[model samples]
Target: MITANPAPEAGTEARTGSSPVRAVTRRKKRQWLPYLLLLPVVVAELLIHIIPMLIGVGMSFLELTQFYIRNWTAAPAAGVGNYRFVLQFDEASGKALLHSFWTTVQFTVIVLALSWLLAMAAAIWTQHAFRGRGLVRTVFLVPYALPVFASVITWSFMLQRDNGMVNHVLVDQLGVTDERPFWLIGDNSFWALIVVEVWRLWPFAFLALTAGMSSIPAEQYEAAAIDGAGVLRSVRWVTLPNLRSVNQVLLLVLFLWTFNEFTVPYTFFGKSAPEQADLISMHIYQNSFVTWNFGTGSAMSVLLLLFLLAVTAVYLLLTRKKDVDA
Candidate 1:
């Protein structure tokens, strides 16, 4: 069946003016590959993150019931109700907003200050002629290596009311106290949280500062030394100033973490519920979980988010956003 043999395939295509499948394939690849590669991430983000956030935004302005059955079916708009309620929110929330704000502030400031101070000291120490400086630096990382939950438990045990290591050391071992210190008592819990918090997070600061110190160009410090800049002068003029961005970013991030952190305090002081230690996060839990007031609880969450956003924005603007690196 010599039926025109369809010419040769390429020749037939050329003659008949049909585009080859390879061209179609290449065209598809050129037109769609990038987007196809991007599709998974876009889909994942929409499903996992974007949808939840939109739901939260919608819920923040709604009065949906527990099961979200749409009791009124009006799309549940609260307009500025949730926001206004939060701005004037007081009665049930107690001093929770204030307490959480201040405690978070206290925790963040101490962690930042102590972390940088200790880190800087250790960094400077390492730069000197010390035996086993590497080992010492490695040892300093033990606390940081402990997971948060384990660390919190360890600290709690140490700070417990009786037989705690801190009390044992300060009283029996050192003769510093007549009796065991009540570290977790209502009166002392706030400060106790602070102490443990600082201890647990200090290693982070130490590591960062140490790395920063090591990264400092040796030539710059050598020049400073040649100009008669002493240790303190070099740190103040060169080291600290150079660390500005890293420090700022760490401070803000740590503050946010502390602000929203719930587990440690919840585990340590729950049932006992220290008034001073009741941070906004805990308050949110109480309202949302304990009291099952989802509306008010969601309101609290929205408020806390707004507060953190504003605070972070203001801080960035004042310290970082406005500064030119020059």
Candidate 2:
């Protein structure tokens, strides 16, 4: 001790001091281990989704066809020519595209409005405590639980003009009309498609709104009641405010899904959809697979994707601005 503690061995001190640095390095490695473990998943996603999406985008710029099915790389370059053909609306194909786009817009709007309203009402009604509420909720979800193909096909059968339940009830029993209505053909096809879609989709909205309603505190309703707010007033003020965020996201998702919907219409009307109910998805399919114009179809697909992205971005921006203002 009197000899300055043997001047503390330099190597010994260095070795002890480096323990913490080693531990920190190991901790950093541990932090990265999870991501490393996720590498396979990321690779799979890129292969399955991102890679095909990129290929589709590239194909949109090329004159790919059934002829190039075996060797896509050899397809000719299009240089936005397909895009111009789609947007110009001067030719028969372009006019059909424009018409399909408008029809999709109208169909989406109608379905979204009806589905949201019906779901909101059902959600609010079910929120109140009552006997057999659980049973009712389960029953409400039956339509959603059914397989889409089965449900749509069943509806198609029911909507048949001859000996169908719908026509039988309206024409035979109710006497609403003297003649059987051709629900699957003519302008009535549009309304028939809407009915089937709404029946299939409303349960999804109901489930979403129900989940949202559960998170709301009972205190808000009590406070509103104290202020003499009736059921309608309380819903308008308290419930709607609490559900605003949910509604915004739900509405957008429904709009996108309905706009891109194919299964219901396809299963209901088959490959040749009525011109009145011709959705963009069916239109693209007819052009690509039926007519063997993969190039133009790819271009339309790209345009649809871009349009959805733009619409989503604009909607989010506007909503964020409104939230900030609020």
Candidate 3:
């Protein structure tokens, strides 16, 4: 016959059961710790970005102008009047806004194309280890690392019509043209803006692309090589496919930054950008500050915010779907 087992002590059973409970408690504490640390950042973001954006959205519905500048809250409400006026298209203000929108679209497209192409080329070139590679990479980053204000100001001075380095080089040294061209004025200003923007932005793109490339496995490239894939072929089949995630992020960020660019245009053309180069940022600024029409400006800003949000959402959705499918 088998002997009966002894019953476990209550204290022993309680201690064994409590162990898991204690572990779970500790795990919860661990999970909450990071959030506790992030509390300050969350608060700061709410204060700095969210609050002001809400206030601006509110201001969009108001008849706030220079008359009520001293007391914005006391301004009369317009109740969507500002939005209606901006979207009327037939009106002068609407026409100006539409023109600026198209200008910004063109500017953003060219910048994205040029910046990505240059960045991609540079990254691919640097992918193969070679002499002076470090120096070349450093040179590429110089434009990105330079102070925006100082660099843009220098560009402004260099772009001067007379007695400028650009003109000097073209007319005196290279003799590309008989007369000095007005780089900071007329249609040339648009091209000048593009050159400066591409020069400034491509380095950052190169940095991002290089980082993406580093994460790609060398064996994959070797395998491609064994399959008779050359440089272009490897990039098409392996490099780009691997870097799809990086390109998605890079292109979206570049698009947003280029679209909202203010400093380059402001520094290049002062308060008034030429009509051809009148980007939406300067347009909004002129409407808000120069005309002292804060209500209209706020409306335009809200529209822009909505547009960017929509674009970002759509892009993320499409990219996520592609990722899932792959």
Candidate 4:
């Protein structure tokens, strides 16, 4: 006689049927896990950057001076009046802004050229195996590693007209100057700013260039040497060609940073930096905080933002085109 098969237990059947559903639920959760992890970062960016930027753009359209600062929302709308006032080149405010822009352009070009030159030289010098190469590399990084406030403040002291180390070296030690020339004022202030900024900036460039050089094969240099290539020729052909991508990114970052530099000038000259050394960033600060013209300052800031965006777009476009052609 055939034995009757026992009926499957109800709970066991339910568990067996629900296993696929549970697996589907777990898979759905895993699919959402990455987005959930990214949620906090997105929220933080919106809160810290996007919201504040929108507020600034809104304030740019309002007359948000000291008169309406307490109740900024109630301030009368100025529309494009602020932009017009700042862009009117014939007026004093416009003239000052134009001067600051040109001065910043000149400063940025000088700093970029000098910093890149020094960094490239140092990177090439340290590329080969030699005695104390590691020590030299460490020394090169000191300026970039130092705290900004501390290093720049020290430079401020050294650039002082009397009893500062710079003057002491130039006048007393080297006899480079007959008198203790003022370094933190007048036309000299521009050079002083350049020196301090170049000191602070070149180390980072050196680090970047050094990293790029590491990816260049030793055989390339050897081949160049066999062809009677000197150091300059080797760099021109082997090193620089290999480092095109790195240099493109490095130069763009340096330009943006130098263009928007604020802390160095503000710290070196307090609120009122000399006209010869007045950068656009400090000029905006003067308009906004010193003169309490928030609307005009905000307008200048928007113009600056637009200008930077345009420049960046053009730079990226040209680089991308070159990359495609290459």
TM-score of predicted structure 2 = 0.90
- List all candidate RMSDs to the true structure: 12.1, 10.9, 10.0, 12.0
Assess candidate 3 and give its TM-score to the true structure: 0.89
For model 3, state the Cα shift of residue 4 in Å. 59
Give the per-residue lDDT digits (tens) of candidate 4, residues 1-326: 11244455634422224587875566556757767999999899999999988888888898888888888888899999999999999999899999999999999999999999999998998998899999999998899888888899999999989979999999999999797899889899999999999999999999999999999999999999999999999999999999988888899889999999998998888768999999999999988987787888888998999999898889988987898898
- What is the C-alpha lDDT profile of model 2 across 89-120, one tens digit per residue? 88898999999999999999999999999999
Clashes of each: 0, 0, 0, 0
Model 3: per-residue Cα lDDT over 82-142, one tens digit each: 9999998998889999999999999999999999999999999999899999999999989
* Candidate of highest lDDT: 3
Stretches > 4 Å off in candidate 2:
1-27
Model 4, residue 229: C-alpha shift (Å): 2.1
Q: Which residue window of length 10 is worst by lDDT in model 1?
A: 8-17
Residue 298 CA error for candidate 4 (Å)?
1.0
**TM-score on alpha carbons, each prediction:** 0.79, 0.90, 0.89, 0.89
Can you write out model 1's per-residue Cα lDDT over 1-326, one digit (the tens) per residue? 11326355543333223557766566556766768899999999999988977666667677644655335355467776765665563644445555666776676676567766776687777865578988987888887787767878878888876778888888888988796668776668878887766676667777776766767788888888999999889888788877776677767776777778787777666444577676668767775766554555676777788889898888887785445654
Model 2 sits at a Cα RMSD from the real structure of 10.9
Candidate 2 local Cα displacement, residue 177, angstroms: 0.8
| Worst window of 10 by summed lDDT in candidate 3 | 1-10
